[model samples]
Target: MASSLTKDSVHPGTPGTEKTFFGHPRGLATLFMTEMWERFSYYGMRALLPLYLVAPGGLHLTAGTATAIYSVYLSLVYLLTLPGGWVADRLLGPRKTVTVAGLIIMLGHLCLALPAAASFYVGLVLVAVGSGLLKANISTMVGHLYNGPKDARRDGGFTLFYIGINLGAFVAPLVIGTIGENVNWHFGFALAALGMALGLAQYLLGGRHLSEQSAVVPTPMTAQEKATTLRKGLIWLAIAVVFYGLVGFTGHFTLNWALIPLTLIGLIVPILVISRILRDKDLDGEERSKVRAYIWFFVAAAVFWMIYDQGGSTLSLFADASAKNTIFGWNFPVSWYQSVNPVMIMALAPVFAWLWLWLNRSGREPSTIVKFSSGLVLVGASFFLFLAPLSIAQDGHKAAAMWLVGIYFFQTVGELTLSPVGLSVTTKMAPKKYASQMMGVWFLAVTAGDSITALLSNPAIGGVNLDKMGFVALESVLAVLAGVAVWMYRGKVNKLMGDVR
Candidate 1:
């Protein structure tokens, strides 16, 4: 089995022979832990952001405003990964880029620990930029550990890596959420900062176990190219600043109005990026077909995440405002609801890993498109569970917590089928020269989803009012779209995937 692995598999030192971490490479342990803590910091802060924005001691913003900011912040976090991947592929390489990004994340959290509104916005900006730089490149480094596309363990390995991500996510809300909701928000932010600091420390200590390819630039830019790129970036920045300033001066710079343009950008950027990739002269016929197939997958994932990612904003608000937090007469913090999805992931991921492997051994494994379709259906169905609670609870009464749990359960199953699998498929289908950048492109689906989510959550801008029927209608439409994709394009997409399955 080891002999079947490519020469570049895993780390340079042991290559295919290493299996120190649960029958995978030793480096998986290091990368797993690094990602674990990064997620801890990220989810920890995220669990509090929407809640804090409406709390009296915090920003005291309205629900619409808070969710708008939350959605936009999350959108930019994924959106920036495109350039972040570019920087890694062309300049610093994954190892250095991830390291520097971690530091920036820590700094952002520290700023959030301060008690000023200006610092709060600054902290969000820093965290968004830093997270953007770190997210895709770190995932790319995981892909670097695999042998060429045929390595049977790749999906399972990514599943295990995803478990590490959920480990942090599971623990974060329990810890940081408790502190932020019960004690002080800034202290909770401070704890999140500490988590990032620890992540960086362990990552540096474990650097030796990683693949050397992670430190090598895939396509190093020449000095002239660097100069040109820098000039272009600065000019774009200047143009954006001037445009924003003019909007503010014209007295039409309300938060909801600002988000409308950002939502459009989110929708448009993916189209532009996909077009560029499809037109790249370097791609062969097979590669072009795969990219085309990926477009369907991308749209499917966007729909899935559009509904799934709402757990932090719309659902959190539901928990805080309407859900009864008592379990056996013990009241709990609403932020703790954030832990449910991750906890479900940790429990179910191993089961899924075994299921996929078993199915593969029998030559009956589902194609990626089938898995994606399943995910979309499950996540979209999770929203219908809300109707049950909404039906029973009347006269401002709180619904049982179990209803939310049920919703999270379905969403968790959907995420297991989709998110990690999406990561694995992106690594497999990426064009050779555009590898890291393709990971970024995958993240752009999340960007698009969150952008749409932001627009939908805000009632001031013709968004869904999120009433009982409105919520049901919005998710129902998404589910129907998912079904249409599978019904119309499944066979074509599977064929275009070439040998990927």
Candidate 2:
């Protein structure tokens, strides 16, 4: 198996730049720091979004309404990932993509500083586009650090990257979320922009750390690349223009009403193309089967994110409304509860990493498919546990903060089982030609889950009580889906994983 191969790794500082750090490149530090700040900017904003929108000092949006906005934002963010990866893989490369995205996100944050409704909506769109450009590409650059596919450090590299994400998440809520909760909401947003600007500056200043992943992979006619690039650019421009125009028309920031369908189209077109890409005779059957399983991988991940993203959307609302959060007789802000999951993840990642290695050596680690199924069940069970307290906390009484902490605890454990494993699964399971694209697709499922969760969080959704519906609906749906998938594909999921174990 590719994962079975191992040796020293290298890191890239710039596209053509290469240097080694303990068998890897010094560039890893630069990229790692950059990703850390980027995540900080992103999560900092996420931790505050629902609160900002619903707070009286902010939008005064209802819990349901705020969640829908968040859902649309999440969906569009991942959907943009398709074009983001395509552009990076075929045009700009990872380093350049990261830089461009950083700048755009900074610009978005600056706009977010404004109090006008237009600025808030406009800022979020920019962030979404920027995230698409950055998220998957940066991780790919890490893979490029190793000269070979089977480098042992690959998982560690990803773990380092994951830490960067949580590192940002960890501190952002404390600073940005708290300020947004207490001060001018826009100030918190401005802080996020500042974080991105710093990340961009650090990345460019330390160009020596980047690897070869940024070099233009040689291609034929220049006009063809230009045409392909232009077509996609124009398509995105059209979507953006139409979307912004409606914000102008409505006096309300209702971008999702336009974005949701466009994103759906974006996701569908790629699945068809990815299928054709996998059929190339140059690929082997084992690779093809692995790729096929990735379809399920994407679907399975969708279920996971549906539960995972509630941290920002529904869970935030739950904290504000019903969570009984007090520590040593001190009451805490509801938004602070949002910080627990990342905290758990940050502390537990190393433990899980070691656990996986130990279990693998002992032949006790679950298969990838089995691990994912178990994760779904774990996450579903978390919801069921929450349900018990939820039923008791009705009538607008604030439930104890332990409820929120407990919710994050179980979900964090499930994420350990699934999210990280699923990410590695993408690289292991895809053809080289389609690795970036499949990663984008894997994220598309994330987008779908976020969007769906966001929509469900909306209080006015066809008269559905978001908190009432989301908790029960999420728990029931995921439980049934996980159970059925595990039962039905128990054999195939394992069979497709040829020698991966």
Candidate 3:
């Protein structure tokens, strides 16, 4: 039986490692709230970004310019996880690293509050790097809260963790974005900073529970461990700073520029090569097999996010352009419609949690990989469901609100299938020594898929035909590709995973 948070909730047979929070670890709730606030800041800022820049006399950028900046910011935010993962694994543990990152992010939000073109670049840089560190590592710590050999409870914990994410997301646009829209744009940024401050406080308050876990397993060093860590830290910082400066400057001027490709090649490719090298260079039996499964899961999740992340890019635009919604006898900001997915996730998660446990009682539950592949198909299927309205409409008129809601519903379910599971898979399968590294790779897939979404929305290529069946056509093709990828690799992938069920 698990212990309670007020007292240490230690697992049976694991002494000294008492669980800390509501039937979970003491630190779990702390991290949960931290993530909640961080996400609140992120999604809140996201709600106002293009609207702030492109709406009326804001920045007055053309659609292409706005989308370019949006996509670049999105891509960089995910891409920096490579360094973030490296820093946590090699130098700082997840806990402290996230501490530094939260500060950076808070500073970034402050920059956004500054009324200058230069503030845009500085604020985004802080946000991208700060998010890169916090995103992968905080999720990893939730796994540590469960200490057992291949502990099955981990996924449920992560799903719960994700619920915190959606909760913050649900409120962010309504609260911060709404304030930014009606009160002041800078106030929205200040709100984001305030949220980050709260996250840092929770993390600091809960540091005791996290001290036990190392973001990475230790490696032998010729010099002292602390010294070696410091050296690597400086090196990583220098590299990141150089790239940050370059990207910050280039992004302001060069569209179709080096930022995406350079960032991808500079950061992501090395991780890929390292993972492959690790796959072939070291391990022998099942360990190596798990490594291979890690690769497969990463590919599958990338495809999933490509479609899923539309919530920010295409879906954000859809809300602004298409959906019709009103609350309290007034039209809610169109962006707030984006809240429906997170809201659905928050409401549905407990039901799915119960459903999974009930199914397990019957000795029937889908494997994580199967769920992931199925998520792609299900989410992809939602496109057709949405396309139906546009297909049948007599003219190129906006589709009804039901269509957007239904699509978000399917996307939320699909996220439930794969996303939380993907995190557990990485933590379980990755080399104990390379946990954060694999997490970084997992994030890379997301960056890749999301970048493709950005590419799709590039107006030079013709903005997605939102009023027609065009968005549906694009996603349908991706779904087919995802299905094919799954068919070809499922056997190899499942075998590597051993008895995951």
Whose lDDT is greatest here? 1
Clashing pairs in 1: none
Worst 10 residues of 2 by lDDT: 1-10
Kindly list the per-residue Cα lDDT of model 2 for residues 1-501, writing each as its tens digit.
111222344443223333343334556667767887888788888888888888888888777667777877888888878777777777776678778999999998888889987888899999999999887777776666654445555555566557667877888888888788777688889999989988888788866656655544422237777898689989999988997888778887554555446445544654665677677887788788877766776777777887777767777787777776679997766667767877888899878777776776787967677778877877787777677557767755667777768878988888887777776767667677665666677788777676666555444445244557455756656665775687479687667767664
Which ranges in model 2 have alpha carbons more than 4 Å from their true place? 1-26, 216-221, 228-256, 259-286, 455-463, 469-477, 480-484
Q: Report the lDDT of model 1 for residue 388.
A: 77
Per-residue C-alpha lDDT of model 3 across residues 432-484, encoded as one tens digit per residue: 66667677777777777767666655665555433347766777678757856
Report the CA-based lDDT of candidate 2 relative to the real structure: 0.72
In the order shown, what is each candidate's alpha-carbon RMSD?
3.4, 4.7, 4.0
- TM-score per prediction, in order, is 0.94, 0.87, 0.87
Residue 334, model 3, lDDT: 62
1 versus 3: better lDDT goes to:
1
Q: Residue 68's C-alpha lDDT in candidate 1? A: 79
Q: What TM-score does structure 1 among the candidates reach?
A: 0.94
Candidate 3: RMSD over Cα atoms? 4.0
Query: Considering lDDT, which of the candidate structures 1 and 2 is the better prediction for this target?
Result: 1
Shift in Å, residue 39, candidate 3: 1.1
Q: lDDT per residue, candidate 1, 347-442, as tens digits?
A: 999999989999999999887877888888888788877677767665668889999999999899989988999999999999999989999999
| Cα shift from native, residue 270, model 1 (Å) | 0.8
Count: clashes, candidate 1: 0
